[model samples]
Target: MSEAMKILFVEDEEALGMVVSDSLRSRGFEVDYHTDGESALQAALENRYDVLVLDVMLPKMDGFSMAREYRKSNRSTPIIFLTARSQTEDVVEGFELGGNDYLKKPFSMEELIVRVKSLAGCALNQENSELEECFVGKYKFSIQKQMLELNGKVKSLTHREAQVLHMLFEKRNQVLERKQVLDQLWGDDSFFNARSMDVFITRLRKYLRDDPSIQIVNIRGIGYKLML
Candidate 1:
């Protein structure tokens, strides 16, 4: 068998932590569990983990703050935030802090497993590793460089923006649901995230404005479809 993936899990709740840690281990993940954010952050910085599962409410520091600090030195490890709070702003804050996924409390082990597996698969996709360039309309996008080139002019994209555009291009000519985009990118489909997605969509529209052949259409109440 292949070596098990390492995971750093931080949760303040004793019972929940035990259950989740055990469950993940049973699924072949090697988990290092911590009960506070300060220690968790230290552990994360000291070791390399394939994924980080963090709870928003914790002692010393919260998950949001821990994630922000961790992102300063490490930008590649995927983070999943677990919280009881379902507020839109909280969800937005998690994403803004560099979290890759979010899970609300009272969640089932099955759902958590699915999310973990999906994230792992996305992170390890060989296609993304092999493919460096994608074409949309008259523009050329360099996946490795995170840049868009049109008519000899190049534009840089933020990490989140590049991720969003990458997904849209992957699903070109197909309707990509709003919730799907939110879940894949921000980890939740909260109202605030939906609004934030709109802003990204608008920015992408401006970037592709020079090419009339490319269009990102909003399917009112549904999602968006990128035409090229």
Candidate 2:
């Protein structure tokens, strides 16, 4: 209900795809239906959709292969797989391939609608949180993708780099205590864990080196502060 969500639905079953696509359209969603994997992948690459509902079994390329290609380009779009394959290994493989959620076939229409709406809502909320561009010197920091882009070149950050940078950006120009940062990030202040936090801080500082205006100052016996 927040915004009209565009959904790309890739199901091979003609009758079921029609029913599901019609139901979604009736409920204020814009649905794009594709019956084959090749066309589904083409549609997905050609257009941007809020969520993707894919069936594993398909003609030509499979759902897993399609998801892999999307991820290689750093597309963080959430995917929900709907397949009759209910084996645990299949589920695990789906997740490992970056599938966010999975639903077995013979699922309820209501359930599918609810799940899609919920996931889309979550994605929208995340987008809203990062509405403003984070200008750390010449680079534009994208919190959602955890990437720093400068002059058309982008560098991806590791998970720790992303998390630490997020916290620092949230408290820009404020001193974040070492213990507090450690506890908040690593969930502990033990000697070994403290070392890990130091490594992350070092990596973040290196990544933000392009921006002379931004510096992570270390306060002895205290913590770090983002000097902007």
Candidate 3:
């Protein structure tokens, strides 16, 4: 078997933390679990972990604060913030504080697993990609690495997300037909697949929104256009 991915998990809720950490261990992840932000922050810096999963609220320091402090030294490791609050500002703050992804409370194990795997895969293989990074407005995009960097903050993109962004970038300032993307990524342009592709487009637009000059435009019935 391949080496198990390591994780630094910080969640104060006893029962929930045990369950989550156990689940991750069962899935072949080596999780170093902690309950407070102080120890978690120290653990994060002293050791290397493939991913960091933190609870928003904790003793001593909150997750956001820990992440902000952690990012000062390490900006590449992907962080998934677990929060009970789903406010827009909270979510935005998490991302701004160097979080790669956020999971609201009541999330299913499957959802967390998918996110952890996707982010871990993106971070682990980054050093192995030789493809030159592409620039989109103010963002540096690495399709092979499945990541986007803006002003030093790195966002890990899902495989499908990276694929869609690459297609849009390759055909910038031109309409990229929805059918084309669907056929390539989803193997069909059916209504269900088309809608799924549209969701990705919306996320790409958000990721690029920091640069107002970069816009992913909807071309009505045709598809979409990347304006930069």
Candidate 4:
């Protein structure tokens, strides 16, 4: 059997820390649990781990600071942050500081597992690989070629457009969080970037407008959801 994925998990809440660490261990993960960012950062520096699961609120140092320090020496390890606050600035700062993924507090174990496995390139249902092409509601989207074809007509998609559409298609029929999309696509969710994404969304709507069966609904205070 392959070695279990190593995780550096830092959470000050003893109860939450225990439950999450135990759950991850039961799921075949090797987790190094810590209660503070200072100790966690030291552990991270001394040892190598495949992934980092950090709680944003911690004593001595916050998760963002820990990750920022870690990145100065290492840039390849995937980091999954846990945050209780819903502020976009905190989330964006985490991304800007080099977080691979972020999970809001109260997240389920199953969702956490999926994100970890996806980043580790292990098995998330099947292979956790990038998608090349997808078909939805009479539209054929080729991400590699950045082309969308429908009803004998085709429209070229920009790189950003293709990336956004790919994400929407991947999470089709589900609410794709705007923060998540912005964090990955534009690296941060500033006002300008958010508005820019709106422009891209509009363009995508125009491209896929011919198909009445498909709809990209704007989910207020959340994000966008693609329904087919």
- Top candidate on TM-score is 1
| 2 or 3, greater by lDDT | 3
lDDT of 4: 0.80
| Predicted candidate 2 versus true structure: per-residue lDDT over 1-228, tens digit per residue | 667899999988899999999999998999999998898888888898889899999889899998888767644566888999877677767766666567778999887876676555442245557444587767898876668898888887543456567677777798888887666544457664455566667767877787778789988889898888
Candidate 3, lDDT over the whole model: 0.81
Over 3-22, each residue of candidate 3 has an lDDT whose tens digit, in order, gives: 89999999999899999999
By lDDT, the best candidate is 1
List where candidate 2 sits over 4 angstroms from the true fold. 123-228
> Candidate 2 at residue 159, lDDT?
37
TM-scores, each model vs. reference: 0.72, 0.58, 0.65, 0.57
Give the Cα lDDT of each candidate: 0.82, 0.75, 0.81, 0.80
- Candidate 4's TM-score reads 0.57
TM-score winner between candidates 2 and 3: 3
lDDT of 1 by residue, 35-141 (tens): 99999999999998878899999999999999999988876577889999988788777876677667888899888876666555443243656678878888999
Q: Each model's RMSD to truth, in Å? A: 4.7, 8.8, 6.5, 10.2
What lDDT would candidate 2 get against the real structure?
0.75
Ten contiguous residues with the weakest lDDT in model 2: 118-127
- Candidate 3 structure, TM-score to reference: 0.65
- What ranking emerges by lDDT with the best candidate at the front? 1, 3, 4, 2
Clashing pairs in 3: none
